[model samples]
Target: MAGNSDPLTPRAKIAVTAGKAVAAASRAAGRGSGSVIGGRVALKLDPDLLARLAQNLDVVLVSATNGKTTTTRLIAEALRAAGPVVSNALGANMPAGITSALAGSSDARYGVIEVDEKYLAGVARDTAPKCIALLNLSRDQLDRAAETRMLAEAWREGLAGSKAVIIANADDPLVVWAASSSPNVVWVAAGQMWKDDAWSCPSCGGVMQRPGDDWFCGECGFRRPTPSWALSGDHVLDPHGSAWPIHLQLPGRANKANAASSAAVAAVFGVPPQVALERMYQVQAVAGRYDVVQFQQRDLRLLLAKNPAGWLETFSLIDPPPTPVILSVNARGADGTDTSWLWDVDYTRLTGHPICVIGDRKLDLAVRLEVANQHFQVCENLDQAVQLCPPGRIEVIANYTAFQDLRRRVGN
Candidate 1:
């Protein structure tokens, strides 16, 4: 609990107490995630809870179709150079989660939060954040989030005339369109690995041409914005060609891009680029991502792939002639009921890689892999999958719920 001299008023205090009590009871009952329910109750009691908690804080909001959690963690790690940083690192990125995080850490003056794609605008308005990290947009949770272009337009409308300094991905055309409305913008070429969502111009509904790293729409004048920061090979290069060597504990070019995005936001906050990059090296995992755990006498490195775009980036992270890979998919409420997005992915990329399928949607994955002509075995369960995998370090790629289940099973 915060100190007695906390800034919250009497009504806010009552709301916070009720929220904490509900959280405690929920945890004791093992019913559901206490973070969401508790926050919902608190907001119902004190509607202005978030706005009050965000007072005098340097709030940084991170939102994307993917990588938001990891990028938010990276930025939070870098921002620690300033002071104690409060963040929701548990992958609960809605109003309830954000409120719970803020109400829990009232003393902290800096907050690095990962906001869900649909809720970014509302949260940004409530917090009036100092900086906003706009990463690439893609097709994720099509049933829940609708189309990626719709989100881009909503973001564009939401961020109009906002004083927050926007750090945006220049490589993603959708991101560029979204952040264009912000008056203060810093564009970074973080490299868009998935361009399927941006093949057509969001501005004029015209076909986009990608010549080298630059993209232009011949029908509309919309083109890739000139970037202030870029990733050249392994180094994060600035305008002067000075390189900041990023040695991350998290393996992947995608993570390196995430680190660069964080570094860009940190720079805008007056933190040195070198300090930001150095801090990012210390982050090995975010909410069970890229964590190696021992289960049933085998070592498994966990990676979360929720959508086709995410799968594309995840596949690039694997080395040539990959290790034994366990691919699990679940079409639960959290993972989205629709699993048809699997066809959008180029599963042929994993043709040479040994694979195993596990989850409620295992058969669906099996059929998809068979159609792709990728050899894979369907396991009865995760343990069976582990038993069937070749002896040595194995990579386990799972969707949302399956990833959470594996993390709990590994005693994370």
Candidate 2:
């Protein structure tokens, strides 16, 4: 076991080696995904090592239905802006993954991570981070995550008495409602998610109606106040209108919500407000998320379509070229044991273009696209799809496993 030896034991070496190989494969496939072999192997060698390792870090953990990776990257960048920081790098958010990230660090005073909701409770208990961040809950991975309500309850229960400072996004009624259970919570706010339609009073299950962008409960008239640290219409600010500019590198209206959330969390570690904003601008899209590529003189938005919400977001970003667009799905068990989820995603965004669908499961992707009332073509493989895609501009929408396949076909 690696436990009987120094930091770089045989198990640790094997884990690190395996992680490097996995990461290399991911990179060679043209995605920037991180690996968890470091932490996984560490756990295999000695089960109780995470607690011992936790004793040496000022760890910060972030979790949410969406935006966890981008938010984690921003927090890491902000921490790095403040001082040296160690990170898992691939947004690996499990106990083993976090351990792997902290495992190989030579100089580590601080670490930041984005964890998945299902694993959050367990990981937090094991790691005992100094600061914890929670983003708003949203519909995602219904087959695995149950319901958003279930996730909110589980997260709050897991965080019940942790001494860590809780940085929570308060604009969402559900998120705010759950955070209220913890009096020690530090609320974060953003203007974009301020939709009165989505808000419901937790006390009475009555609609919480909005008045001039502020809200009040319709049933009992119990009202939750606006957030103390929210992003203003065009600028970032504290409660007192302290105008600040958060330079977010990603495009779209929703990125603002993520940028604001990251800034609020960075403040917990004493990173300057402006640096959080600046680093957001420095934050580029991670691989397979909203990655754009230029192939054969054509502009391609190579995005990963996972759960329904994630697919909806991609549809919003993809301005389907006047020419046919390439949409691909993978059927490998590792990619997603089942590919039936393609039916749930809204494909209305594929309008106005003849879509080119490609993958091992070409029929499935084509059927989904056709169901949405879009003209479509099926390709046996991405190699053929790329060839058919006009040389000037191509937008490739793909599944998780297909990301590597696409990169291999595209040669990075």
Candidate 3:
């Protein structure tokens, strides 16, 4: 259904049609949403299909180790106030999944994409985004992804000479170093909760000096840029010093930072801060991050935390002590094969809560919890885990694949 002005060729049209058919078949087979496989088939038919599908629409690319999916969803919601926007709302951030999303909505006026950190440069080249949001960079999927500093360097090199307006996090040193190459950047003082990855300056390999919410490199003079937009407690302050109070349905301070970044990106698209914030306030969940579902007379709140940085933020979102928490983890390909990152998290924080562990890697988690001097019950499955808990609201935090499995089982 692409308009006449769009550059999709006859072969590309056929590819898109075939991809739709494949997607339909995949959905029927219950093999997943079929976005990635469908787009893979389309690209096989037409290697230039992604660029062709992205021809005339304004595009925005969001990339980060964490919060890419949530921030992409927030920005997409805010942009929808302006016009029809197509986005990978299901947390699909790869090239294939992105192409599938665009191909599904040919007539959309705007395309908001979530690009994986490693694939940001390639997707940006194809989409020619109008704006790019660079959230914090932290170590995730270490078995697969490059180290934090290397990824920051790659972002810096990959985004060089691009015409896109970069909306970056000023509080994250890795993000600042990555976005500094761009001539046009809107810096947002989104607070970074996990600072372990940025203790050393990425620019000069020198020790970083932090004093009173500001950071500077002692060896090379690299410092945190003056933010045009900042998050001050419960309110977001614009460059003009106008504070917009954010009342989002999402929980945690991490989401507040995400909102600040989203509002900045929406402003570049000519959306007012108030309008953008109002629109973003409507989003209660991203993919399945904070969805609550019923299971065996108990309310299960589903939370996804993939890395140490993510886990640090997720801990604050849980209900207070004695509210019972269920922690699940998996070391599948989607999640990193290495479970060494488990040592990085402070599981001891859940000391007073009734905790249950269930996953493919439950034993590994049990060892970590044991080492942390925390008491927990190791269950065979979710049913056993829930049965052990008193019937009430329980928090469930899972990593990537385990979260998906729980979503399927709970039918959320």
On TM-score, the leading prediction is 3
Instruction: Kindly list the per-residue Cα lDDT of model 1 for residues 27-117, writing each as its tens digit.
Output: 8998656888888889899999898788757899999988999999999999899778899888789998899878888668688989998
What is each predicted model's overall lDDT from 0 to 1?
A: 0.88, 0.69, 0.92
Better of 2 and 3 by TM-score: 3
Model 1: lDDT of residue 273:
81
State how far residue 357 of model 1 sits from its true place (Å).
0.7
How far out, in Å, is residue 348 in model 1? 1.1
The 10-residue segment with the lowest total lDDT in model 1: 1-10
Predictions ranked by lDDT, top down? Answer: 3, 1, 2
Clashing pairs in 1: none
Candidate 3 vs. truth: CA RMSD? 1.5
Question: Per-residue alpha-carbon lDDT of model 2 for 1-412, expressed as tens digits?
Answer: 1122244445545655565566567667755444565466557766666655555667888887667777788788888877777876676777777776776574666778778788888877877788888876765554566667677778768888778888787666666665666657876665424242256676567877877656667888666545767767657676566878766667655677677777777887888788778877767777545666766666676777655656666666666457557877776754545666677676876778667887778887777776778877776776676677666666677776777678766666
